[model samples]
Target: MPERGATGPRVLLRRLREVMAQPASAQVRLDRIVKIIAADMVAEVCSIYLKRQPQVLELFATEGLNPDAVHKTTMRVGEGLIGDIAANAAALNLADAQASPKFAYKPETGEDPYQSLMGVPILRDGRVLGVLAVQNQTRRHYTDEEVEALETVAMVVAEMVTGDLIDPASLSGEEGRIGPRLVKGLALCDGVAIGTAVLHEPRVEVHSLIAEDPEAERMRLLRAVDELRASLEELFARAELGAMKGEHREILETYLMFAEDKGWLRRMTEAVEQGLTAEAAAERVHNETRARMLRQTDPYLRERLHDLDDLTNRLLRKLVGEETAAVYALPDDAVVIARAMGPAELLDYPRDKLAGVVLEDGSPTAHVTILARALDIPMVGRVGEMADLLRTGDPVIVDGEAGEIHLRPAPDVLEAFRAKTKLRAQRRAAFARARTLPPVTRDGVRIALNMNAGLPFDLPHLAETNADGIGLFRTELQYMIGSEMPRLNAQSAFYREVLDTAGDKPVVFRTLDLGGDKLLPYGRQLHEDNPALGWRAIRMALDRPALLRYQIRALLEAAGGRALWLMFPMVADVTEFDAARALVDHELGRLDRFGKPRPADLKVGAMLEVPSLAMRIRAMAGRADFISVGSNDLLQFYFAADRGNPRLAGRYERLSPAALGLLRHIVTEAEAAGIPVSLCGEMAGRPLEAMALVALGFRALSMPAAAIGPVKLMVRSLTIATAERFILDRLTSPAATIRRELEEFAFHEGVIV
Candidate 1:
């Protein structure tokens, strides 16, 4: 206890208030707080620790023992005396602390003559931010008044650290520029992504520290462990009946095992025994484990890294006391920068809040990348070694499709990026405006434009793009997102919504096309050297009658007397198409007999995506009502190029004479058979390709919502007769530079600049 002449509580508070009022930094305020506390308590040392980041308590200011160590040291959530207080969300006061059972000594901190110690957690909203402590050489017990006074001081310090003492300079600027600029490693996902950088969303950092009381610490750990077990139970319970496959559930079970690992819990207890906070201990272990795993060469072990990272993040939150939302805070329109992102994690993020994604590690074939493409967010990936170079609030630019990034760009660079953004917006706007106009050449040749929809939001494109109707609605995406195999009623609801949205326009719904690269949420795996050639589309459907029958029934129920146009994807030959058509007929006949509702008029079609289908198109033309070319996959197969393989990407050209010849053949056969031919793929989204389709006598072209405007503009500028002649003339020519040739054609035709 201090002597009667020592600084009064009122005086100490006033001085702290004064120090905090100044425009000085955290370091300065912290120093002043430590000095006042030491003087008032007549202690040999006074220290303040602040939560600088997740599970990280940094030593900000101190007096007495090793002043040099102050601001130069950091501990995990549950490190030493200070960490323990913060971790447990409690206070500690002891005379002769060195002799206490819970005492932890640090060699780097050097020796201290202190015989007494008092510590308190700096808390906000019942959450621990850090700790404040004072030590005295005299062997003496701290009084209740002394503890109260110290707690009051801690409150003041917490306020300062938490930005309760805000300076204009402290706040992040409107443009995300503040403090000393920092560069960080960013994870990229998509190859072409461009958007404004924004702050990461906040997630729970730390939870609670190990209690000083052995029994109490044990109870806390056990409770957290139980909660973890419950989490796993719920996950498993949901998975049992959910849409996800057994393998996904297996991954979840593995995560549960990692959480319950005996070694992990033992380390937590050890930290508590050492008087380190629980959060600190867990974080230390997690970081060490991460470091070790990073060095491992095994692929299986490396994948386990994600499991560990997730479990550690969860355990650390429980220990240090933080929520998952604290990990990032994003604006409505912002780009995400991260080391990497799992597909599940990406689902939690708001689509509107996400403008683009920049990743440090990701490939174009990654699931998250596919999702990014689906969302139409520009993304750039594989910019390794960015996390260390960039800070949380630093400016970043990502070009998703192009795979480019600019950090702390110069004025000219910023202007150029902004200009590029404006041009893209302008182009999109132009496309939307053209949607109202018919997809016809300036000479007045009519062409049918449609949209390829997967989600409900995609329905609006039918109206916005002035598309004739949905040429292809991928029915499997709904199943991919759900937890269970969606009931027939649920599928009916969505199908009805799409049809109603289209009104009188034709809406072609594709059956559940799962297999190959497209993974099913439910556990069903058959490893093959080439999945693309293996079971998929009609092949998988033919085997899984239950899956195919369900979709057919849903379509029939949803049609509700309306005209329903349906198609089967990846039909290899006329026989597959015939078999698929027979199945649909069987379903229709069964529904009629059972008095189940179905469309009064249904048009059945098949996608000419496979090369075999194209070869047998003449036979298929008479058997099928309509034929739509799935050009994206068709071109890949035609050239023997794996479209998703980055190494082989850009190796094959869609405009190559061979691919074009096949397309011409399909169109001619379809025309001769008097069947309407359309294209639903990425190629149709391009302006020049839209023109090519027009020349090839494809009256219908279906694309994504965003591409409608651009393609419309190209259609409006084209002269169908001239385009056909120009393309045919080049078809026989020996062209080494096809892209250049196409560009020259576009320039000559005045379809694009």
Candidate 2:
């Protein structure tokens, strides 16, 4: 084998450009290109296998082998060396190609004489377009230089395959064009939205692949790196961000570190030296990194891929002189698609025009999910690798309620969703009519329907839904959104604004439920194996008394001369509640010492999230004012399942007899001891779940604002006595869940659930 030099790839790329410039059929150009690759690399065979679909690769063109195999040979992804390259989006080099376990021989290809083979994936925007390979008869290893040269050539090949040179329609199979596809994911926010898909951060197309001046391209790459670094540094230098302390700060620091990474710079600089434009260098390097990271099983390492992708995108845009603007000329009804994004990024869109959001990766507890909930936008998450499957203007239906995404739906499917949307609008109007009605059932049992809130944005919904009060005020959101810890006055002012907006309506303030998934930007970072069960909520508060005291003082000051309702979350036993209550008492004492005004009335409660708390509820009632069943956490803890894990999402049934039994026990115990009990969790937001809870003796339900009206209508139509009797009969049943039964009952009884 001859020594492969640095200029070999450049020379090949120059010839390929000449072929692409000539007016010829795609087939003719591809045929000539393969011949050039075979001669330049001095290989026995050179083949180009284009991805016909997600799972299959077809031989498109070849040289130095049987021409009969050009359009006939095919292999499933991961079936052979070519397939392996496509599946993993990585290169393969072999001294003896036939010895590898992944080798798949095709008689038509007539390549049994080949001994060594080297292949590289033709990648664009982190997606595998095809595989480019060279085979040699002699048993020999491909050098690193040879591998780099092949990868560089493959990059140029990707441009040709995806560009006007090769029509995707011609390469595609009998499907003609991509058709309607339904993808399932997790519901982050519940609603339904019909819109066109729009990528949150669209990839900037690099038109100039080959560099006219390598030195100029190298300088351009360096300049973009410096600008990227300066921008991130300026962000960190802002007053609020400068004082940031914990997880959020750490994330930004990581972003900055990546922007200044020497290894990343070296890779892109080398790509430029290999004769690619600055933008192309960034694109190539990012594509390579993303492909390698996508195959990693380590979640932490895989997650960092998003950071790398974002940084590289910024650099690419800079190189192309594109402005870093958040706004886009989006369609009137646009659904944003992203791998993952922050709350601020979501807020950048024109909310009125933005209909929904779909994330390839996201969780219910993610800040963006919370923002989506507050803004009343439909959002579905964990839709794997959607960016590659979807186009910018494709019609999409975000069925967030069902956690389904319908991409380019057939006419009938689209019409059905349109009808569903119409019906949903009608239901909303009905809910609005029942907004001011009392939540009194036909059996004369009065239930309290309250809204759960956190941000000030949720305040208007209190009036819109006409909720009885704010049942669960998640205080952690204020801390989560800011870069630095909110000072006493700022916290106090925000709380005051909430109270003022509520007017006479009671608000239950749950003290900073910080740790766990709701970690603060300014708090100490904790790495926990099982964060849900680790030091969180009341546990973190008690351990850090000053943090609790600061928040308590703010709440106290904010509620001066008004009634104050506060709760301690994740209380395991009476002792924990007692300790947390003691902090509130201390804050009241401090107010008195400073001659400051105090709340006219104070009610301290325990949030029943831990299972052990149920056993101690009787004692808890004696000391606490009320008990709010944190059903979301309690049910997960009872079932010993992580709520965030998608695999376990359907494994545990929240409507199971055991779950209701436990909740029934808590309500019974709390009632016997003369303490008011309410449920404030995701379960309360669903009409069916709320109906079951009512049957189990829960009278107070706090849910998302959108749910109050529907739950209210259900309550007004239900007869508690009949519901109780029906539910009691099933409490001892062997059924895994009573969901179907409940739905049937609601339908027959006209319960509006």
Please report the candidate that would top TM-score against the real structure.
2
lDDT of 1 by residue, 706-741 (tens): 667777788788888887887777766566335566
Query: Which residue ranges in model 2 land beyond 4 Å of their true spot?
Result: 1-180, 195-202, 207-277, 280-356, 363-377, 390-395, 408-415, 521-526
Clashing pairs in 2: none
lDDT values, one for every candidate: 0.69, 0.85
- TM-score of every candidate: 0.61, 0.69
Instruction: List runs of model 1 lying over 4 Å from the truth.
Output: 1-318, 321-334, 340-356, 360-395, 401-403, 407-415
> Best by lDDT, which number?
2
Weakest 10 consecutive residues of candidate 2 by summed lDDT: 168-177
